[model samples]
Target: MIKNIQRTLIELANIHRFVMRFYREVFMPPYEFKEIIRQCYVVGWKSLPLISLTGFITGVVFTNQSRPSLAEFGATSWLPALISIAIIRALAPLVTALIASGKVGSQIGAELGSMKVTEQIDAMEVSGTNPFKFLVVSRVLATTISIPILSFYTAAVGLFGAFLSVNQNENTSFRVYFDQVFDAVTFLDMFSLVLKAVVFGFTIGIVGCYQGYHSSKGTEGVGRAANWAVVMSMFLVFVEEILIVQIIQAMRA
Candidate 1:
């Protein structure tokens, strides 16, 4: 068991190394622009509705849940401000990261894992086509490109949801609610939030490709890779968030 665990770790590390090298190679000659764009459509645009729906519902629920607590202390006026802080600073990015990790990360892992099991990747290599460059690089580039757009859409929809929820009790216009919301935002908030989302996207792609590429060539191995990709991405996303928040706090001080 210990040997198996150790070997798995080593395999994962090697996969990461290959992915990074492929990423470097990707930017070089004979760029696979078409494949990258196709991946963007698959990983980004297809996933937009899911991210937007999740973000909107989350914001709406958060506002509804927190209203009574704030109202009890006669703090109703702070609703808009708190909602903005939550979305712009933490909630928006965190939720969007989770969504991307599941959608993009799992898809990358499963797709590569399937190809690996079917020997298609080996076939590409034999045919003198760089499988790593064609597959891994395209997906990673798609992920990196897609995440920011997804976050922007999610944040906007989430704030809109918050507005709808606030209207449940408060009699504020959309403009007024948004004014309070955006009023609380600062460069520190936006910077950390956006930076974190980008990193989170990179993490999802790297980890997913790593697990899938190195998994043994079998259906069971493919399933295991897919499962573990989601698990590891979630863990990494939280770690990144904590580190980012600490850095932000330090900068503030």
Candidate 2:
């Protein structure tokens, strides 16, 4: 078990290095700037609506579930502040990471894997086109830029949803709720959480693309890449969450 873990860690480190190298290559000569913009449109704006809707619902459900627990302790009045902190610091980014891993990560893996199996990757090379630059970097950059913005949008919608949920059993204005939320949440909290989301998004895109581009087991390889991308991204996001929390705590101290 220890050996397996060690080997896997080494493999992951190598893959991360490869992703970085490809990113640098993409920026050098004959830039594929168009693809990057297209991907941003596809990954960002197209993803916003769904992410926002889900984020709102997640906030509502989270508030509803936690509200009763706090109310049992005679702390219903604390709902807005607590919910805001929860959404801003943890829930929005974490949940969005999971959703994006499953959605965009799998899509990237499958698309790249399919292209590889079809010999299109070889064609790109034959035509003197850097496939990794045009395809992988574009998508990866899109995800990196998009996820944080989506996370912010999600946070706003989520807070709004929490506001509405609070009104279901009590009377709380949006202004009052947001004020309390901002009061409890520090700038560090925003920076840390959003930074973590950006990292998570980059990991999801790059890892997914890596797995897909390198897969070689025929049709089975494509499926494997998608599966691994989702799993790897989720695990990495969880690990990062722990590391980020520690960093935040250390910074506060």
Off by over 4 Å in 1: 1-12
Per-residue lDDT over 169-198 for candidate 1, one digit per residue giving the tens place of the 0 to 100 score: 798889999899989999998898788888
TM-score per prediction, in order, is: 0.93, 0.92
Error of 1 at 104 (Å): 1.8
Go through the candidates in order and give each one's C-alpha lDDT. 0.87, 0.87
Candidate 2's C-alpha runs over 4 A off are: 1-16
Q: Locate the minimum summed-lDDT window of 10 residues in model 2.
A: 23-32
For residues 18-109, write the lDDT of model 2, one tens digit per residue: 87787678668877778888987887787777888899999899989998799899999899889888898998888888888988898899
Instruction: Tell me how many residue pairs clash in candidate 1.
Output: 0
